[model samples]
Target: MNYLVCVLLIGVGATAVMDLWAIARKRLFGIPSLDYGLVGRWFAYLARGRFRHDAIATTPPIRGERLIGWTLHYLIGIAFATILLGIWGLTWVRHPTIWPALIVGIGTVAAPFLVMQPGMGAGIAASRTPRPAVARLQSLITHGIFGLGLYAAGWMTSFFYTP
Candidate 1:
């Protein structure tokens, strides 16, 4: 149905925008946002019904790892859609506001900078990465993209329920 297509399109568009932004950061500041090779591997593993986090970061991630990471990222976006649906139902689905997206996006940043980054040996906020400032910038940008995805998903749901 058209609604389904819209959901896919918006979710994918937001994610793609985020990814392209990452690539731009790499070229401009000399650091990769994610491992595209890894993303491809994730699809392959999905057929096998298994995904691995691999815990690799010193170098470019392998195909499988990036795939797993990206897959998880997408699924997370889908979850945000679930939240919108639960609260607002069909009506909320049709026209998701920017506030929810922005709040969720910004709110999600806490763990990575405070816990994950340091735990990963990145000092703080991924400061150990090739470009810390750039990494932080990418995080903010990517989270914003995720928020945009929430809005898209909600809008798509509206098309389906007509409320």
Candidate 2:
């Protein structure tokens, strides 16, 4: 397996795992999943010279926003996988350690806390939400789950692309 192919598979697989967790959480805990449509709306606004919003949920619906958001979600996963592989190299990919994956996965929370949430008007780390602590906790847990996904995906990828 090519390095890029391995990375893509690992990333997509990990992201799928995260999505599954979201669905399960929603069903079992009655927690709402992050609305990717808002993500799509954010991207759509980029073309219109807008980058931030006070409340992305209030923003007008954009055409194909769902598609755009879902695509970006997977692409972002791939990008993160690239970052992981870049730092850890092929050795880590072959070995599939847990620490690096968890570190990278948890570190990803910064993107939402500092960038996404602020851009979507959820305040930093979801402080603007009605339940700030709960939101923050959810984000942490979700990212941790993503970290686990990364580890799982890495292990799976190693089966096909052994060092």
All models: lDDT?
0.58, 0.90
Error of 1 at 9 (Å): 7.7
lDDT of candidate 2 over 1-163, digit per residue (tens): 7889988998998899999999999999999898898899998998899878989988999999999999998998888888889999888878899999999999988989998898888999998999999999999999888889989999998888955
| Error at 50, model 1, angstroms | 18
Candidate 2 error regions (>4 Å)? none
Against the correct fold, how does model 1 do in TM-score? 0.59
Top-TM-score candidate index: 2
Which consecutive 10 residues in model 1 have the weakest lDDT in total? 51-60
Pairs clashing in candidate 2?
none
Candidate 1 residue-wise lDDT, 79-125, digit = tens: 55444444544444456677865676566677567754564456567
Instruction: Give candidate 1's error at residue 3 in angstroms.
Output: 12
Against the true structure, what is every candidate's RMSD?
5.6, 0.9
